[model samples]
Target: MDDNADALDPTPTRGATRTRTALRRVPFTLGFLAVVFLLGLFTGGLWSRLDRRSWYPEIAYGWPPLTEGKFWTPVTGWVFGLTPGQYLCMAILFGASVAWAEWRLGTARTVLVCASGQLAGILVASVTVGLLAHTHLAWADRLAEVRDVGFTTAAISALAAVSATLRSPWRLRVRAALMAYVAITFLFESTFADLMHLIALAVWLPLGEKLFSRTEHGFWPRTRREVRMLAFTGLLVIAAASVAVYFFPGNSLLGPTGDERGSFWSTLLTVLVIAVVADQLRKGKRWAWWATIAYGVLHVTLTLILLGVAIGTDYATTGAVTVGTGLLWAGEVALLYGGRGAFRVPLRRKITEGALTGTEPGVAVRELLARYGGSTMSWMTTWPENKYWFPADGERYVAYQRHAGTVIALTDPVGPPDLLPDTIAAFTDRCEADGLVPCLFSTTAAVADIAGELGWRSAQIAEDTIVDLPALEFKGKAWQDIRSAINKATKEGIEFRLVELADEPFAVIAQVRAISEEWVGEKGLPEMGFTLGGVEEALDPAVRVGLAIDTKGIVHGVTSWLPVYGPGDEIRGWTLDVMRRRPDGFRPVIEFLIASSCQAFKEEGAEIVSLSGAPLARSTDTADTEPIDRLLEGLGAAMEPYYGFRSLHAFKAKFQPRHEPVFLCYRDEADLPRIGIALTKAYLPEVSAKDLIALGATGH
Candidate 1:
């Protein structure tokens, strides 16, 4: 036991040994950089006038070493104008640029990012370039992405991806800013830098670090999934780049004769670099600049082969072709593995809890998609339920789907283990031989656990909520307070008449939109009101509108409700959607709605009526819990502000409802980035980080 305990510890000192091992692996990277440096020096020559204005390209005869062909005349013709010293420095700079990332992530990890990032960047940039180039838009529109729509932009973009996926905070800010400046300097000053790198980084670090923190095996298949997504994305990128480059024209990309745009060395260089870079991506680096380089190679190779057959080549000029290919090979290789630890001296890694053991961002995406065509299992939108089996809140829809052989899905919060055992059995009996089984996206673990406890097979679908709405007994002091508030509203002439959804005073959709926008923005509140595809996402067919109108036909406040149900059960829920009262007296919309929903549901023989969760925006940024909680601690005592927690709790006090704590738990843990991305695309399509963090914390 003691030996096992000690082994599991892997103490700090033991962990430090790994760091030492990591440092030891630096030679591969150093050697690689050294080769680039010397060659750059050789080509740049020994000296020149010390002024800075003069700079030119040159060939380092041995740094990459010339190997073949008579294509030397044109290639050397451009290089002869440069001083050898200048060429060496430029090569050295490029090598150093490649080395920066290797120092941070550990050689293997760094190499992974470089290789994969390069392949991804190249392919993406190439396609984007090609698409923009070939579009029928005007020159201004075609060149809108950059002053020059060519492969150099693709190259920078590929590098940005490498840096974004692997660079640390400080390095990212500085390097990214520097990259932007250079890209702008060379391309279009007003462009958005073909920077897919930031996305790569966002996808890489958080997921990689989080997943890797788990036992290493949890990371394997997930990593494969990320690689797969990168591959698909790479192909898409190439198509976009192709359009951008070929259809656009700018002096920055024009190769002498502006007509030689797509035929330029720079464009070819960007595409060609892809093969070299993609070859280097290991770990996260494996997809490095793939599509971009592939496009370039295809274009250049075909052009050259056709040219050779048409015009013919002589052995004397072979040196030029060799130089061109060599410079390309060196840059591609150097940049391809251009990550922090790709060529680092090896150091033993430390295993500290919560410290990043590894990072595999978006690595889980494909694994999810492979199992399901999408990353999430939402309440709506799936063809499988029609093809498969799903239960809706409605029986007719369910019957129609079953009859039509369409997929239908449903969720049950909490009830008997066999809450739907009969339903599942019936479906199974109907489609037993075919393997199409009815699915239950359960709300409570107790419900799902029972299915498993009963020897029935099941899979976790989703998590939901239920409120234990007790009777509206006026026995308690708080319940009495709720009653009193309703009495006051009636006395003040605030009446509630339940109207059909279509008979509401204002346009339901437009009114909800205005209130929602205000709540999400200026109102310091948030809602899950289903802004898009209408309010039906969260509401049932029993929905009703309670408009608080005055004698003048003026709207004072508005509320909505519905009777929610379960097998052999039903309850009333008052949705306090929008409440704006005149200053003569603010109407207690909560009191009226609760009273209305209760009366309606009770008459229908429902046992209890739920006021529902306060639809206050709980998005992290808008949530005011911190200050309220702080007051509870008496931290830095002060005259309590009027509207803060002081007012919020006061309103809830009227209902005097029992507190039902809602906890947001995940499957061991949750993917925050995925959640954030998901939420932004959901409630607030324009949501920020605060939105995701808030949404991720949400529960019914």
Candidate 2:
């Protein structure tokens, strides 16, 4: 089965159909907004402040109105806004949020949720204010006499209810943003509307899952990226709260705010500091985590002390602001502690145990690979971006990249097979000691078996396409495409040249760079790293570059090959890496280059030529795939339009090569989330959040 098929199954016609269906699905949302709009227009509340009207208090809901037997206030309140600005804001928020909820939950369910939530919020807030009115709580007492109108409470409730249907990362994000909005607004600007909003959210947030969720994934973060996002959201909420109070502070549910409670400059400085630390937290920095934890503890302890003093002395003011902020801090601390594994990246780079220190790790890795020869991907270990960990014997090493607190070993150890177990064990232990998740990517079955023996789980992530040179021929029907490509290249006078890229003249190198850059410029994301190399990697003397040039020496296409070594420093085969072609030049240039390159290598007595494993692309699927497999399948589909890894995997079938499965071996499923993030970073090391957001916006 095609694993990525389901992800890419939506056609343009199907997408248009879905869009049309969704537009028709939100009738209740449209009706609700219409009712509010028409009511405002008829009552002149859209242009003038409703409070200025003599009959406003009769329709606005609050404790005083409810106690006076104005039982119709709650229903009437939903149809009016206080002013034109409030109408506009409510229309925008309600249109977007209620429309979305209606689309996801259907019109009937949405109507039920919004109506019930509106009534519940009005009653709860009024009752709450009524209970606390004469209890000397200044904020509640002041709000008890006031009334409010709007559908904001209903809008928020609908959003919270639909949050149950969202998938991870977004599910957490929307909920956090909603909670932060209500909490911050109520604490610093406790309007009756804000109190109703908070009440609606509190009541519907947990209950929504039981009512609306079709499939419930656990609430905890499932990926390192989610953990970072949550941490960032927490810090951002803190900063937002400080900004809110500084700009619009007064008597709130949490007592006095702004200058009355703290200095303006101090609040600004605190916000700036928190903003910086929050960014670091998003990057999973260990030092930032510690700093945040300490900040949380300090706030919690101070709040406790203040509460103790108030309780002992019978003080009327309970320092409610401090207590609320302390509670927020406590939640942040709990989140940090639970996801501590995501924050193991240190403030400074530290050497792993038994890591090469005195000499260049890349040089050591290359020498070891040359001396003892490893898997098809062993040559990739020599890349400059990798770090090498040596065993006690100093003869073996594993090349890995540290990202998102994961030690992602690229392939297998480059040493004797007999020492494989020891090397794997040592690496795992070192990662454990360093508090890093350990995993191997694009590794051989031997390594997977070894990892399994050490209690690790393995899943096939890609298939390495290998063309046995001795058996390769273009004489049969299966080789029709290859033969046709070669014939076309010959007719066009496309000459093939294989040489060390770095030895080429400046003009040739420039043309090669231009071709590669043009290819990269077309991609939505930057050129990938890790197992995938580029023109720079082809510049290595040991790597060979295959060029398709016309009679006039205009380069049409280019390909790079890394030598795969066997025992005794023998060059056993070549693994293909970089492949690029001029978009306007030679339609079959890639096939021609590969076929010619294979012929050249075969003439040199090389046993096989590897097309290399296409990242996140599998040749086949298993019936009993795990959750991780499905996750990867979805990721592959999302990335297909940008990177086309699955397309490349399919194209390699033209060569009729044997497929060798490559596995990603890890300690357990718990580490898969971090591993996924680490792999993304390793592949797109230069990708920024803006780039990712843009990519996602493309719906790929």
Candidate 3:
């Protein structure tokens, strides 16, 4: 306990550097057990006999127990195994679990949890067996005769206790798996050891808080509503397993003698129950939570009554199994009752913590992007239409816009590469909470893989054309088209001029505006904006607008570029945005303007220039024949006649730029209709569906 202890906080507050805080003390628990195992190996079966000798007195709760005091059994039993295989198994589990637990909970808590779990589990299991045996229950004979001399009970319990210190959904997954294993073993295996494992779990789960609260953040299902959902989900899982055991002969504790038809129908009913209840739990339906609680109470009561009758009629061979099953049901019942307050939220409304940086989301995100920088779409986040979602640490952000009841994230999250997955999860969680479909739009293939890990699907939607400035030359045969356009513009006295649009003269601004208006007028629909910008966007002083102007000062073609930023405010390159031309002025005007812009950017120390991506335009790849690909292809075809995204892409290809595929990552295909509408709104915020359909029919 010193100033150094303060730095051991793994997830430090903002502005705190993450330091690798090593354990203050080495975990001696595993080392000590290794020594004992070695000692037992060298003792020629002496320690094994000593282990049996000590067990006789300690378990007084068992029948025919020794009167002589052998108080060391509880502690010594873990040290001496009857076989080398047993010792080796215990050693592996003990070493890994103890070391990890000690690192997280520290040495003292780890040792205390393990020791207390071991002693309490054995004593309680022995007592339960001994009481049943005194009453002459059929299956109780084996429990009093068995010597449970292993570290499994303690190790598993310690693992469970330490897991409470972990975060979700990993924590939820681990705890669920551990509970399932113990319950399944007790129901099917029906061994004294299985009972001991359950007892160990039961003992350690509630006692973990006393040992350590260092990792508790109260961010998970600690709420009353969440606890109730946990109860319902837990009960449903156990009920489903119980039904499976009943149907599958030889897997049941009753030794497979039940009626097959009865088990089959019951199992089917249980499965249906599980499906309904689980869905309800996920949706946070309070009525379903209450229904699950009612089911648990009725199920446990009926099982206990039937269990009593079976034992009374001497028909029960494994009464311990029945009792264990009853305990599992009763545990679910207690959990439901305890978490009754947790089921308050309705199906549509969800809870949220709001902004990650404790400031206005947009402002905080802008600051983050300015400091860290991002990919090509990063500048789009600064667009007035977008909102931001950040992870708990505020290290990254998912820039998104709301459309068609879906929260569509614009590209993948931008920030530290390592935090992308967690940031995606946090953003998705926020969307789910707000009752909106979550999706990632225009993400890269690598980013798609990250979303795929979260059970999302990806479809290639567009291809970005980027030119390597240093390697590009208009003199080559491949650049013939671009070369011709540039030479023709030069011969016609059309000069390439790069200027700050905001700093330009009023006449120049009026000319650029007229060219944009003329270009929109021919499209037969309203001017588009989201990922596509217009004159207003070009007016930013930081943006470099390149114009192809004739000697008489008439603007022939205009191209605006957004600075692709690198670290520390350095400009990496520029992305082409507003590319427009006066129809009567120049036929090869766009090509001339793009070629001139590239040369200017190249001369300014830029390495590459992105002609930008054409939305809904994808190159054919044999491997990418998914249903979404076809759907997007058809959609692209329908809009191509009017929007000409493909035509735009083909036009950009005249520069012979390298193409990079862009993807749309989403959670489910069912959201495609909404996603489609959202994408339309995002790209053409000013255009209406009626106008789009009219233009599509006209085929202009």
Candidate 4:
């Protein structure tokens, strides 16, 4: 016990070891930057000369020394900055970028990418400045002697390089934000530093992927039509923003003259061109990619030309603003052109909304079911409340009901096992296309595992009590309650009889209906359907009905069973449903009926008997403590007194049936609330909001 206690202690040595292990796991690039920054801070101005220039000889990469001889400037300049603020900023940017890039591309490649980007950007900027100075361009002449000294360029380059390693949506969002910030900066406040940063990003973006090619595919605007719509939406936002700025008072952001005619026409032409490209891209036109790329190039070129003209004509108040405009355009160009592959999905033949909604599971669907079999709840697919979705192959199908923007499947795909995955995919894809959330309620574990692959979350709602008929016997000590109930019923001359209700006499059927009506009335709620059954489902020709009857043939209780069909239409099992007991009859009649029915099924060579599930009832698996689970627990409590679902589950436990967990599976955790509401509606479609609210007070 002392040894065990000692082992459990979080000792200082153990803590230190853990800390060291975690530190070792951190990317070396990040750790190095952190150490350097701290040391630099402690050293005060030791790294700088009296002239406010870097004390390191290799720090001059541009301006004063544009020589290729200063080969170490690209590497050594990364560690030195003009001010503490610049040093701190570089530390933060490089720390994040290098850490992420090194973690993804490893140390050697990250070093190569950063170094190459820095060298390329410095060389390009210096050469451009020299050429422009010879041409007498005032903007270039002013920038010619501006010493570029910071890690901002290389840091941004690293960021751009690491972006290609990210998955979609995130990849798209990060690249967009990075490029947008850079472009906007250059557009509104173009500086020599900004130009070099942009050059660095451009150099690094393509190189990252060439070295480490990884792709993340997901279904967002999963269809071609969605891509087209997204492009049009983008166009609208741009036009609206442009128009708002153009008409604003004292706004010379676009141009000093503020020529509304040219601006409006130019904006319209741009929108038209974008719309055309989007449509062509939707149709899988190869040239659309290049056309959009050219547009991006032209956009950046025009912005630079305008900035140069403004500077040359002396209309540019601040070179910063002109540079900002140029950078913003450049960033926009990179983002717009960098994500070319995002629109490469081959266009599928257009599926009309009418065809999607009107599709019915016909004869082929029935044949597939007979061939492949399905779950106990699969027969509920024929219920009028559900809509069936069949894949084009008609080999499998899923039934669902839509409410409150959520399309909830009643169970797993109920046809061929091989086609189950594809059927679910098709259903979810349709939901995505129509902008509806898809979910599966009361699904089996196998189906839940399949949904998990599609990134679905799950909550255990109830457990199906399946009794093994072959192993069931009334001799065990645990079977005392069931045996006593049977004995009492026998002494009272009540007989248990299983018969098809369709062949029953009119009087028997009427009595059974009266029992069902009384049960429904006692609940003070509508007759629930979906997985549950009422008198209507019990009356089906194929459903077997069990009756607790007296010697006089008067029925005291009735329980219906739906046959669980095997691959060859053989009745391998039975699912109990539509349990109704007479108000004034024998107290133990329901128990006697269930026990006797199990015995009868055993005699009939059935392998198992399912007592079905109590809706909204929970099991012992409280491992998932998500808010959705808590909310569901509260909901179950709210309706517990009225429905007694948990009580029913407890009663079903008397038989010692194996508890098979049933789950409600859904795509995306963000939609769990909507899914909860949809499940409520699916279970109690006829109950009004007021009725549900008043339920707690009435306690039926």
For residue 449, model 2's alpha carbon misses the true position, in angstroms, by: 12
Structure candidate 2, residue pairs in collision: none
On TM-score, who's better, 1 or 4? 4
Per residue, candidate 3 scores C-alpha lDDT tens digits across 186-299 of: 766667667888899887776664444343422234322235446666766676555755655332334432433245676688678778786776554667767877876786
Instruction: List TM-score per model, in order.
Output: 0.32, 0.60, 0.48, 0.48
- Which regions of candidate 4 deviate over 4 angstroms? 1-366, 621-624, 696-700
Candidate 1 global CA lDDT score: 0.36
TM accuracy, model 1 = 0.32
Query: For candidate 2, which ten residues in a row score worst on lDDT?
Result: 348-357
Candidate 2 Cα outliers beyond 4 Å, as residue runs: 1-24, 215-218, 260-265, 316-321, 347-411, 414-700
lDDT of 2 by residue, 575-600 (tens): 99999998789999999999999999
Give the candidate order by descending lDDT.
2, 3, 4, 1
lDDT of 1 at 247: 55
lDDT of each: 0.36, 0.84, 0.70, 0.68
Specify the highest-lDDT model's number.
Answer: 2
lDDT of 1 by residue, 330-446 (tens): 333333222211211112233222222232212221122222221011212211111222233212111112212212233232223333455444454555465433333222344
Candidate 1: residue 104 Cα off by (Å): 56
